[model samples]
Target chain A: MDLIRKTNTSYLIFLAFLMPIMIGADYFLIQYLFNSEVEETLLHEEERIQYHLAKDGDLPISNYLHEVTPIDKGFELNPKFKDTLFFEAYTDKNIPYRLYSFSSSIDQKPVKITLRHMLPEIEELIWFFFIATFAILLLLVIGLYLIHQEIYRSTWHPFFKNLSMLKQYDFSKMESTQLNSSGIREFEEINQVIITLMEQVRKDFQNLKEFNENISHEIQTPLAIIRNKVVHLLESKNLNKNELRQVESIYQETNKLSKIGKALTLISRIENQEFKRLDRVDVSTLVENILNNMEEIINFKNLDISTELQPMTIECDHILADILFTNLINNAIQHNKEGGWIKIRLSTDTFEITNCGDVSEVKPDKLFDRFQKGSSSKDSLGLGLAINQKICEIYEFTLNYESKEEIHTFSLRFKA
Target chain B: MKVLVIEDNLELLQDIKSFLEEEGNICEIAPTYKSAMGKIGFFPYDILVVDITLPDGNGLDIIREVKKENIDIGIIIISAKNSVGDKIHGLEIGADDYLTKPFYLAELNARIKALYRRKAYQGSREIYFNEIKIKPDSYEIFINDKPMNLTKKEFDIIHFFVVNKHRLLTKEAIAEHLWGDHIEMADSYKFIYTHLANLRKKIGELGGKNYIQSIYSVGYKFTDQEWT
Candidate 1:
């Protein structure tokens, strides 16, 4: 799957196809050359026999030329000769021979002469050359593959380093990323592009953060002004009943508006990673404090409360953790029925709060969404669970909600 | 007590000025950082209520200038930003208290009174409404020189009422004052009625005059005079 393996496999396939063709060509070439040399020697032997018969009027005895017979009559008038191969069984191993047969005259008489040469030595030489060529080809392929592997590793080292750096980059830190120059043009180009892109992204993030802060500040001041004015009007002793009702309605609506504004701002801030200070926050202590603070509300409704908390600690921003716990507990208390029971269980890695309430009409999937209020509660801004979910996301914690059998449960699972 | 309020919004400035003035404190208003700095340079005041973001300059600079003069002026930063950084920064630079915007005027009044008490009086600052006396630090109350049993929240409500005497305290404001952030998620402000009733009952049982009057559908007003 990797580059080196793919290249090596292809190269091996090519060698597999090329090796046999090379060996076959060498075999044929060595066979042809050896056959020609045997033919030459046979022809020279024939010529010498003829020369001896012509000079001394008798044929010279030669070991290479055998089966020399003088044809007295009915000898073939044709003097054609041909070279052929035959098996010689006189030795322990049957060996092949190159034999040339021809018709000639000895002492003015026609004679048939045949010369044969064994080819076992040339066969052995061909085998040796075939094996040596195969070995060389194999060594060449292996050496090239190893060289390629080394080059690949060294060449891609900088690319892999840059990849890991990109993976570990955290936008919240806004620290500029430094990439080592690999001296490779393509890799350097990639690093430059990434650096420019990240810089732009950081700039955009900063601008959006500032804009959110400014908008929140701008909106809150006017809301405060309207609220204070309404307060002053409500304080007057000279207002009619209708006017008083109007003032009270205005004041209440303004309060809701203020809450929504604050909740939105808090969500944006969390998303922006503004709360970055982390500390060892004890979960049990925070839940206890919140429960204690809500005691009055529980008493007002006469609801039964129970807590099963184990000592648990997580590293997180303290204020955000407080808000997270506060929202969960507050939701449980606010949604519970009068005289209902509430239960909280905290373990080493999880916290769950369940309360007896009417079966919620809001869908489970839409529970953590902003402005998703229960059908019965008209006063809720519906931002409580949303804020809690955002805080959980910031900490990589899991927040889940379920409602069944007239009971509502919210759970948080912290990552260790 | 004399106070200087530096705020950009005219209506809010007027409201704060009128409310504090009605509470029997001499209140002056500066609509910008420049005027506020000019006023502080020439005048001595008991408290400086500054909004952090001003049109001319930062209210923090005003705080710096006031502190540089060593005038012993109590500073309460009232800003719209609920940012923890800003609050910590302001407090670190000697701001006595920080109140986020959209706060109730009664809450503001209580914070100002508390700040003034802490700055002007080292300890032993007791608030009196007719014969009812409240020791805020010790969370104790006396009616006609006799001690009365009061819960912490009861003590706080009465303390708030006594501090902002004769002012209408909305139920929402009282809720926020009692339960700061939790009040937002509260289903209703009806719980305040229980505390209010218990406070009135305890005060009445102590042979004290009933000064807490509910203004029918509006809120409660605390005063020394009897109302029908």
Candidate 2:
């Protein structure tokens, strides 16, 4: 599946087919050359026999010739060439030979002379060449494969290293990755492009963060001035009843505006990932402390509060953790019915808070959305649960809300 | 008491100066950090109310400079940026208290008074309003030299009234002073009235004079003199 193995397999298949064909070609070529050499020796033997016959005026006996048959009629005009088997007296076995027969005149009568050459020596020479060629081809293939593996590993090392660096890069930290220069031109180009892109993204992110902070600060200053001016105006001793009522409404609206402004800033800050300080916060103790802080509100509503806590710790921003639990507990207290019971359970990996309240009129899907208020409380800014959800998202925790049978439950699960 | 208010906003600064002046304190204003530095270098005041962000410079630097010149001057940082980082940083640089913006003027007054008292007395300070006396450190109150039983919230309300005696206190300011930021989520300020009524009843049961007077539909005013 990887590049090196895929190429090696294809090369091996090609070699598997080519090896046998190369050996067969060598075999045929060697055989043809050996046959020509045998033919030359046969011609020499025939000439020597002819010379002896002419000198002695009779055929001479020799080990090369086993038999000489005399024909009753004249021989044919052309020579006949064929392969035949002859028996050897010493070994008592049939040996293969290349036999050539021709017609010649002996004592003015036509007779045929044949010469034979045994082929066992040429067969052994062909076998030796075939095996040697195969061994050489095998060695060449193995050497090429090893060289290719080494080249592949060294060439692709920088690419894989860059890939891991990209994986570990975090935008929140705003730290640039230091890329090593690969001598390869293409890899260097790719690394340069990525570095430029990341720098641009970080610049854009910083600009957006500054914009949010500026807007929040700019808006809050004027709002503060307006609220303070109204308070100062209300201190006048000559204002009538209607004037007092109007000023009171103005003061209350300013307060509400201030609250909404702060909440919006907090939500944006969470979304921007500004809270980077993380610690191992004890979630159980945090919940207990929040519940105790909300004791007055709970008592005012005459709600019976109970908690089951198992010590649990999670890594999160400490201030955000405080806000998370405060919002959850406040939501529970604000919505609970008079004389209702509130139950909280904390475990190693999960924390759940449930309270008895009137059937919620807010849609289940929109419960954690900003400005989504319940029908009962109009004064609520409705950003509490939304902020809590944002914090959970930042920390990679799961926040869920469910309402059934007049009981509303909020649960958070920490990633293990 | 002589106080210096360093704020960039002209209108808010004027209001704070006039309000504190009406409360029988000498008040001065510096609308920028450079002017504030000039004023603190030349003038010695009981307290310095500083805004963390100023038009010319940072209020934190002003705090550091003032602390170096005079360690006895109390510093309260006011900022529209309600971040915990700024608050902690300001306190670390010798600020005695931190108040986020859009805060009530009454709340500001109470913090200024408390800071001044802490600086002047060091410890073992008691506030007296006619026959009502409060020991803030011990969380004990005595009416006509007899111990009075009160809850934490009740005691805080009484202490706040005694510090800002004869000054009109709004329900919103009282709620903020008692509950801090949590007061924003309340559907009504009616709980504050309940706490005040209970405090009044307890004081009357202890044979103490009634000093808390309602200012019609506005709020309440705690003064020894009766006003119609």
Candidate 3:
């Protein structure tokens, strides 16, 4: 940011310096050209005055040249002193003539007028130079302004305009938002730095995923072995009723452990990006299907599920969407009081699943954080909403939690 | 009744086979999908126990094939994938029961018998557990085969307790099993007490042994030991 600011400031300053210098040079030349033209006008007057006085009266020509008063300081030469002003003039060399300049102020003063003829043409040259210089300076300033705009459009605009995309980049898809090679060495350097940081982050994430997958697989096999062996021992016919009950406790604990492990593994996979995008899913149908299977439990718990389903379709990762929906629904069903009421609503692109419960023990903002339970419900691992939030992040879906009147509502809105 | 158990694991298969045989039911074994498909094709067994993750293909596919052949077979899918979708899929594909793997043989056997009862009589039979007998079709209960008047909920509570006997049942599980998932809204187990009270009064009036034991802060248990 500082570098861009520096470049922009330097460009502006260079243009600023160029503009007034050119303008001042043209202004000086214009003043010089105007004064010279006035001097030529007075010289013509001097000649006419000298001729008229010399021919018509007894006054000497030198006296007449000196007698004309200066009109103003516009001309470099004073009208009275035009003949006495130093100048160079030339005629064809074939016609040689004696040249003299008469001094009008001093009696009998000889004044040379040889170079006075060239003064008018030199004045014209000065005028043309001033006009051309002024025109060029005006054009140059305009050109600089346009060049500044073009540079801003090509460089600064793109750099600053697309910066929000960088801000909103989902860290899960780090590789997808990689910067294209800008060809500019400075930008390329910055891009390389960003890519290096992202690559390191990606590598760390990969290592974490590998670690989690290994842990899950390692723990799973042993848990599975233990569960099967327990079942096998229970059926061996050597155990009495008391022993069987003891074995039952082991099975229950194993079941809970398996559940926690499965949730953890799923979370890691979500973190690891092992999900695929499938067909567009009708969320209403998915919710209905889950609810149908949950019917037995719902009825047994005496919960009332009121639904307002709309025909809505969303292109989503089926596995992630399933996990998201199931976890939310199961959480609602698991944490509520018996005979609780669950209300579900679906619009064209929004879904709201609300369940009545006591959540005074929880802050709503922290509800989506892992293992933050609002209640001491044994079945809840509190990873449900966190996993759901993660899935939402992966798919760019939005999940919002709102509580009102003791009703907890999870709202999911799909991007169009 | 003969049950054809199709599982890839030899020890678990043997355990299930022995456990069922001990329960006085004939047990047949098939270790691979091909063998299970072959046995299912030729054998007229009462129940077909299938493990979903087979060496050849999914056990759910076999269930579909059997259904397509118009064979009235009772299939119980046993899988290590305890995902809700897997269970729902297995059952939706015409499997009579879905049991997650590493389940006790007793649980498997119980599911098989439940499937048997469901398929054989379409849930119309008088099931007996010692002196307590239940006629599900008529929603009737009897002690020593003598009729006992019980309320609707009392009968349901007893039926659930009897079917899931010798299991550590949580209050939530019991409530969900009885009322539905909606039981999450129930303030307490006060209604459970009401149902148990009604059931006990009816059974006591019938001069039957009282087996209901309140497991303080947990749930009630019905055992044949104390009852006898």
User: Largest DockQ belongs to which candidate?
Assistant: 1
Off by over 4 Å in 3: A1-18, A25-253, A265-362, A390-397, A403-416, B4-23, B27-45, B54-73, B82-96, B102-107, B118-126, B130-160, B164-222
True contacts kept of 3: 0.03
> What tens digits encode model 1's per-residue C-alpha lDDT throughout B133-215?
88888999999989999767677888888888888888778877877853355554777777677778888898998888897
Cα miss at A356, model 3 (Å)?
6.8
- Order of all candidates by lDDT, from best down to worst? 1, 2, 3
Cα interface RMSD of each candidate: 2.1, 2.4, 7.1
TM-score for chain B in model 1:
0.95
Superposition error at A152 for model 3 (Å): 7.6
True contacts kept of 1: 0.56
Specify the CAPRI tier of model 2: acceptable
Q: Highest lDDT among the candidates is held by which one?
A: 1
Cα lDDT tens digits for candidate 1, A101-124 = 777776577887776776656568
Q: Tell me how large the interface RMSD of candidate 3 is.
A: 7.1
- Who is ahead in DockQ, 1 or 2? 1
- Give candidate 1 regions above 4 Å deviation: A1-141, A233-257, A264-283, A301-304, A308-317, A331-416, B41-44, B68-70, B119-133, B140-151, B161-171, B182-184, B188-228
Select the stronger candidate by lDDT from 1 and 3. 1
Across A1-416, the per-residue lDDT of candidate 2 in tens digits comes to 98888999998999889878988888887788777887777777778778877787677775466356566674464765577787889989878888776666578666778878887654676678778987898898888888897877888888888888888776755567788787999989988999899899878877776786677667877887887777666766778889988988897788778888788788777876778888899988898877665565666678898899999799998989988888888788878787899999998999999999889888988988988988778778888888888899888899998989799999999887
| Chain A TM value for model 1 | 0.70
Worst 10 residues of 2 chain A by lDDT: A66-75
